[model samples]
Target: MVLNMQPMRTDSTIPRIVICGNLEFASAECESLFKGVAEVLVMNSLSSADLIEGMQPGGRYEGAVGILRQWNGFSHMQRAFIEALPSSVKYISSLGAGYDMIDIDACKEKGIIVAHTPGVGNDATAVTALYLIISALRRFSVAERQLRAGLFDASRVTQGRRDPTVRTLAILGLGGIGLRLAELVHAFPMRVVYHNRRPFVGAPEWCEYYGPGRLDEMLAMADVLSVHVPLRKDTVGLVDEAMIRKLKKGAVLINTARGKVVDEEAMIRALEDEHLSAVGLDVFPDEPTVNPRLLELPNATLLPHLGSISSDAQKLMEVRGLTNLRDLVLGLNVADLVPECR
Candidate 1:
């Protein structure tokens, strides 16, 4: 795990880079971003033994673009591969803001630089959260299903949508996406409150800040709750049965954050008891395979992790990922290095 903070041999030469694991799920334009600027290699997702052939070090590939989704919960051999990368390879770039999937400690020990698209996904993801909030509040999913089932009587759909002006929105994490979503919804004159590790200084005048000690007060007061936190040890299962009990009855919950952040069974139970009116989720506890109970719930809006799925957003993320690689090749401060790495 030799660290290589020094610049690459020169700036004029094209850096040889490799795209590891699955590529089909990535943006279609991803490969073209490095055209004529870097020698690119595509490697299929394989177990440790399979990666040995044709994956040698020493200028064969000096940079790697790792798809976090593909690398989620990487195997031990994969960790070894990353740490044992050839001397020529010194940079690893993840597609988006979350680097939780990659073995960052291994990269750091190897003196490898890691970077991601920090701000590229904010707008798209915020828009998805907004969409979920509107749909869940209005119960549009239930109405659509009933309509498709030949029960088109508009009277059957409950007029349960809460007026934004009368509702209080409590944002759990006021990161990039949370701030953007606040701007998007404040037009409705919704009363906004947010809880963060520390108060967000220089916040908009309309938004209220709640420190950790005031969480119970915020939870009890919110008519709609939107979670925008990252997946970390402290946040996994952060919202559980006890926390749900604190929410306003019939409150709507929107989670565009990581699935593991909320307790799924507890949420399902609360929904079943009518304690929660509706739930909207773009992520799940076990991704690609959702809880069957959530699928059966009439009041739940489930999506296949669509936070950053837009074509435009996809391209922007790839461009940013590639740009980080370009910057490393030309010797620039890694702008989006994860805080822990820095």
Candidate 2:
């Protein structure tokens, strides 16, 4: 599946960039941008073995200076893959906002600069979070399930439905996605409070800010808790049993962030015990395979991680990712380089 866009040239003066996956939305744009600047090689295979082999001494990607890969092109880009990359490979651009699948520490060790598509999918993902919040709060998933099973009793389905009016929404991270969701829920007139490492400057007056040390206080006041932080070493299992216990009883929980950020088992226990009135999730601890226990819960609303799959978002992400690679090869500053690299 590896197709060299151009034949190997004897002259090594021109830099080479290897595209590790297909760009369904931005192929033409990629060619136009890279024209005459760098030799482009398209690696269509999704197999890690194929990529590793291509990076070998005498392989097709022996002299590749940059790599651009699709978000789901292969499995984790960990230490092994970093070690396999040719010394000429100095930069990598991945088409997604969250680069948790890429081992930043490993990339650092190899002196590789990594960039990701950020901000382009914020609106799409924020809208998805808003959808989950409303659906969970209103118990729409339960209603839909009952209707599909021919058990459509209005009284039964409306038992635990809650309205967003006057409810307090506590956001765990007030980054771009979190702020967008905050603005969205303002339509419902829900009171918004966010916990961040520091106060976000120029925040709307209606949106209250809580310092990092006041997370428990914010959780205690929230009727709805939405998580929007990235998955990092310190954030994994951040919303564990103890943290979830601090939330107001019967609080609705929504997570569009990485699943491992919250302890799934602990959340499930809270739901079973009625401590959590409802739960909504777009990402799971083990993606593509959700826990059966969550599926069985009447109050649990779930999605298959389709937060940023809109056509517009897809095209923007592809273009930004490719631009990052192009800029790196051209010796320009990379705007979307991962924070760890900067």
Candidate 3:
């Protein structure tokens, strides 16, 4: 339902923008930025049904030209919801870098421009990955668990732990987050190798680039394997049992990217047999409900999808999403369009 938090201008000539989710840090900034430019309508929607109903003809958001969306308890912006959008809705500015939740195919059919905040969360997510890498390699979580259980044997917990120094760190995807992670790991003096569709021309000289054909070779040589690929049709279950077996035995695994990119069952089996010394995961295949087996593993360092929740990252994402909507309303080309839309 549309929230009448403030008086909205009735001028049909003025463009209307709807905010689908609450901004934790940038609410005031959103108001100020679009004060004189467009009529900002806040949507108090509980589910996709509410949003779909509101976007219908002669509905509350019938006149909205743009929507700034965030995670509002809905799983995705599927084709059904997209089809319900009024003809006036021309733009969708999403809050995060990943636009997998939105159906790009549907948006394309409707001629709706989609934009996402890409670089805003890179550093925050990279730092989270770096922390996981160190924690997993050093067996920090295992040590903490042992100490908490009153086992107090430092020698036992530290028996097979390894350091990040002088190790080969293989990144599966060399996008913004992966590149930032490589730079962070370089400080530890770890050798970095990245696999991409093609060579990243902007990659640092010290970073070794491995083409798609050499993915298995890169995996075999890695002391620590970090998955950074986005979740897509081709990437779901990309790192399957065979790929997990390719990694050197006892190698640490880190995944800050989407969880479905790696085969969760295969990864769990590897960890169970001690083929992987440890694993650090920030994202899970099924969020808010992690596997019970993973929770029981001492060598696993798990985070509740906190990779991009830093205060700075949160504010930047909010501002970036709002800016995309603002730009589109002003007839300016929006930046950070999703790959499919681009």
Candidate 4:
């Protein structure tokens, strides 16, 4: 995709916003959406360190939008960027659902605003999670491999399928995407249970809610466990060796959540030991690079984080991020402000 940076023009007293990270984040279409509302700056040519240093302490940067795919986790460079945000920059809107890379605390402490594209990607991401659930539980990958290799014709083969309608699905996180997953999972043949920080007040009656130190119970009850939590201080490696061992024997593990949420080595051990029947993953601990061992495993189904790649979802996300920036610029309440920023 051709990336362009429009010359800074002040045709009116419109807001001046900065767009950072990869050229893909500041797509031409994304920049076009800001027309007549804000002056968009695409800082693709600048390195992260340069981005941080380019900001003058008193510059008139009213807002910033980030679509950093390579920034899988927050680092000192990101912290430095957050610290260097000009005083006029009231809000920093990120393109994706997770804002773990953006320093919420720094923004809150500085009285600057930060927002995320939360629900825009829900439908597509939830569908991807459900796809993993079915593919992992039913051994679709292995069956496909054998069929393509002519093993299916060479010998009689049989594998048991764990019907979703017949088993209970435990959703590990009940946030936007998780709730969407629950909405779809409830319609399937299986029962649904979810664990969140607190019991969701208005969840559908058919869906069960578990909270306040009930992860183990959730793990035990799950015939198919799908993780949906974010990566945070409390969630990094949350599912460790001990936790992996808590699964019901011959159960499927589905993680569309952050890969760091599950202990990769422990998970591999569990798979080898037959503690976990099969595993499906979208996000990995590292992006564009996965554990080589996982690729070699026959019981694992891997996806290259195709959760929110849908054009519809991506455009909506860009609109949402721009909306937050525009709203904050007008001194109005940002509809999609992160809780910490609010």
Off by more than 4 A, model 4? 12-14, 21-36, 53-77, 86-88, 147-156
- Candidate 4 weakest lDDT stretch, 10 residues: 67-76
When 3 and 4 are scored with lDDT, the better candidate is: 3
**lDDT at position 324, candidate 1:** 76
lDDT per residue for candidate 3 within 1-342, as digits (tens), equals: 233355246667778888887767787888888877888877776566777688777777777889888654355788988987888888999988888889999999999999989989999999999999999998888887878888887626557788999999999989899999999999989999999999887999999999978988999999999999999999999989999999999998899989899999999999999899899999999888999999999889999998998889999998989988898888887668887777
**TM-score, candidate number 1:** 0.84
lDDT on C-alpha atoms for all candidate structures: 0.74, 0.87, 0.87, 0.73
In what order do the candidates fall by TM-score, top score first?
2, 3, 4, 1
Per-residue lDDT over 1-342 for candidate 1, one digit per residue giving the tens place of the 0 to 100 score: 111122223343566665544443343444455555555555443444444444554333334323232232232323677665555567777777777666777887777777877878899999999888888888888888888888899626557765566578899999889999999899887789999989776679788998989999999999889998888889999988998889999998899999999998999999999999999999998878999989899889988887987777876776677667766665778788777767
Question: How well is each residue in 45-92 modelled by candidate 2, as lDDT tens digits?
Answer: 777788778878888767888888776576478888888887888999
lDDT of 1 at 318: 63
Top TM-score model: 2
List runs of model 3 lying over 4 Å from the truth.
1-4, 7-12, 154-156
- Each prediction's TM-score versus the true structure: 0.84, 0.94, 0.93, 0.85
Candidate 1, which ten residues in sequence have the lowest lDDT sum? 1-10
Q: After superposition, how far is residue 333 of candidate 1 from its true place, in Å?
A: 1.3
Residues 191-261, candidate 4, lDDT per residue (tens digit)?
88888888877778777888868878888888888888889989999888887788798888888888899
